[model samples]
Target chain A: MARPARRGGGYWVYLIPSLVLFLVVIVVPFAMNVTTSFTRWSGVGTPTWVGLGNYAKLLRDERFWASFQHNVGLIVAMAVVPTIIGLVLAAALFDYIGRRFGTRTASALRAAYYLPQVLPVAVAGVVWGWMLHPSYGAVNQIFGLKVNWLGDSDIALATVMAVMVWFQLGYPVVIFMAGLQRADPALHEAAEIDGASWWRRFWHITIPQIRPEIFVVLLTCTIAALKVFGPIFVLTRGGPGSATMVPSYFSYLNFFQKADVGYGSAIATVLALIIVVVTFLFLRLQERDS
Target chain B: MRTLRAPGGPPGRWAVLAALVVLAVVMLFPFVIVTLNAIKSPAEYSSGGPLSLPQGVYLDGIVEFWQRVDFGRKLWNSFLISGTVALAAVVLSVLNAYAIGIGRVRGRLWILVFFLVANTLPQEALVYPLYYLAKQAGLYDSTLAVIVIFTVIQAAFGTYLLSAVLGQFPREILEAAALDGAGRWRTLWRIVVPISRPTLSVLVIFFFIWTWNEFFLPLIFLISNDNQTVPVALGVLQGDKMMDATMSSASALLGIVPAVAFFLIFQRTLTRGITVGAVK
Candidate 1:
């Protein structure tokens, strides 16, 4: 550690390349998003300054609100339901599987559960799209009924959410398993000695201990849900009267399909702010805990 | 086997096992369905229903799907793009992570904060401007666009992973390398890298899977068919006339093989990478 000055120089020097790339690819574009959202750019010619016109339009855009509602629906499907199920599954595995089978079985079970996460989003999208194809799709055949899984506007968002839940379920299960592993064994044994039932012990001991993991799962899943595109992009394509539309894909459509770059940028910028704000909120909670 | 404790405990364990098995089946449902459907002829898929066994194993759907998409080129394109980006990301991450993570530099914490925020920013926010930029630079519709975009994004994530690797380095080895009169570059290349190879492989795999799965950037930038990547090509095929249920199942199956195989092969390390990255 002789020449601390030169060492510092090397450190700062190494950050430059990645930083430059970050600034160019991320920072500059983000700044442009802020500016472009204020202008009417059709992505072909010069952008005209519009000054919050797009933002004003977005405030009243039914499709925008509908997509945002779908995002909320996605949150329920992708985050809340999966986290609940994942928690129960993880608890069951942690509390029971360890004693009954072994760590090997538990681990194998986790790997199996995480199988869907291994596949690319596009692959999942395509596979589910086929299975959910309203007419002759397998899902309907298997259910022994004619159900429009992806065609009915009323249920299309729900169907997409179901797929999102499936795609996202594995992530939380994995995280929760790890979190549950860190819980003190003696604490559980002590609770058991007090005649605590499985459900009660889990609620009192497991949930409180793994709150951080739950928060992490929730934040990640919520963000992922809010930003979901690939499955919707490939599955429904915002179909059945924009039923399954999400902010990310909606923004994509606005930019490319509608050729309304200014409005698209506005939608994206708002979504970006939501993510950042939520992230910061989570960070604050995490920091305060620490 | 002799009677003994199983895993988590004795009570309610069978129930947990049953539940896990159910969840596992749900998770593998798509894979099973795809595998069964992909080998079947389209007529069988429509007529025979979901649980119907293939009358004969007609592998021609996959064969035809392969040729129709000219998937060989797209496959090469995927490998080229993913390999190039993963390698670049790993290299850049090693250097950048060494600086902030191992160098004990001032503001290293702040630098990591910047990275955290950067990584959190969604691609939707950046793609529009990137589209405009790529067009002006004459890089639009080129594989270079996809490669560069993925490299930059993956490097941000890779930096976080590799930084953890550097953080876990044994100080003694680093000091020994320095005392042996090895320059920083030599120490990093020969000593630090050798020690961090496992973690580096984790980062590489992470980038490879992430880059291969990337869709939006290529969709926006690579407008032409020949330049499109696997996921983008697959995305286009989702809407194309030639694509059908059986054919797309074939495409989906083939597209996921490399990634899913990699996951199975490196499940331990990749799982550790994720849990360590997110939870820790």
Candidate 2:
């Protein structure tokens, strides 16, 4: 069919505005950030080049490493734990609750679970902060313990991670629900007819069917964890010292707070690069599966 | 429905529902607490249990919060800035997506691909440069600048989404219109647009919610109190009086009201919208 000669101004017109805007907003800024990393420039005045100094300083920067490690932990937590939990929740909903409660009620319940995703990060953080306030907050009262959720360096990152998981689960759950909806009912019925147990069908058939959705969720969650700036910015602000510092926070501090625009740009560039590489790898895996 | 009871007994169904309800409660707890606290007097808020109700209903806390937070100006600012941004972005995206997605002229494959790539780049990567650019253009501390920057940043994704929706549209309809002597513009307005109403509605809701909730762009672009969006205003209100629980709680409630309203209205669509591309 030769794709029916492919329709409207094809590539040029459609590409121009988006391409120009993106190049100006994304590509140019990214390049500028790389250049800034190499030069020492405050938010004001002209810049002077200082080759590899920022990277060198970053090499010995314990806080930078701490932030980087936290990002890795975040990505892992977002991917592994949430994926399992979301899958279980989705399976339970699809196989049990959803079918009984009726589709409308099931969807309403899903919307309730997904409500957090729509909330502003600032609001989410404050609400969580209030809830986790060590002394007067709900968490302490509920648990009958006086542990400072944000003040304690040891638990601060963990606290941040927990909030992140809670707020983000809604999106993944919806995705899993959609995947479950598309699954072939006949496979389950056939397995049941053959005397296959529910667990066996779920393990051998259900999991494989939704593998693509799983990969998509993992990729998004990882990327989200890597670029988590807003929630951390609002909730802990890198916390009782650098406990909750992630790469995004580190970059923000370097650029805006410290006025080390160059080093900050470098951090931003590295983070972008990491995201691109991760996304590329994810796409490749999907391609292979297809 | 029959399949459910056939395998898992009623107990199993109840157990699942209970767990889901527990998770739902966890999700809603903060909003509930904040609402209850916002209505209480400061002393009442500070002294009462976190989950307890107000001893007496009082608009005083909300009134005090409104004054301290300059919430009237903030709400106005949010409405003006976000409304403009959403409108501009959606309009531009509709034109762009229609042209590129359906009109699929000679080079659209590459353009479509470019847009897809553009959609994935982190918005954080663009902030500093945009900041400097806005400054140079004398847009520093202007609400207009925030509106424009957000509109531009959002255009790519809006195009990406609208195009996906437009892609499902049958080309034969457009072809039929074209054969009937309709020009490209007419075909679009008379044919493509009307059929694309559902997608457009979804985009409208999507952009409205996103622009309303957006924080970073406003934080970076609009520095003045008069120009600040709701999120920035809330942050500043917190910074200004960290101790006033009544004011803080009230401000939090104000900030969430619109989003909560939007969620309630479009609960079904919003969840689907959120998950649309996550698995694809």
Pick out the ten consecutive residues of candidate 1 chain A with the lowest summed lDDT: A1-10
DockQ of 1: 0.59
TM-scores of all predicted structures: 0.94, 0.92
Tens digits of lDDT, candidate 2, A131-218: 6766566678666789988889998888888887777777777888889888998998788789997678878887898989999898
lDDT of 1 by residue, A41-113 (tens): 8888799999989999998999999999988999999999999989998887776776567778878887778
Who wins the lDDT comparison? 1
Mark the 10 consecutive residues where model 2 chain B has the least summed lDDT: B235-244
Tens-digit per-residue lDDT, B146-240, candidate 2 = 77767766777788778777877896897787678776667677988788877676677787778888776787777877788877777544434
Point to the candidate with the largest TM-score.
1
The lDDT of each candidate is: 0.83, 0.76
On DockQ, the candidate that comes out on top is: 1
Per-residue lDDT, model 2, residue B207, is 79
Q: Mind giving the per-residue lDDT tens digits that candidate 1 earns over B1-280? A: 2124344346655666786898889888888888888888988887886688898789898999887778888878888999999999889888888887788678777877777778888899999898889889988889887787788888877776667668878989888878777777788899888888887887787788888888777777877767777877777677456677788778778866766887878877888877766764
DockQ of 2: 0.47
| lDDT for B126 (candidate 1) | 93
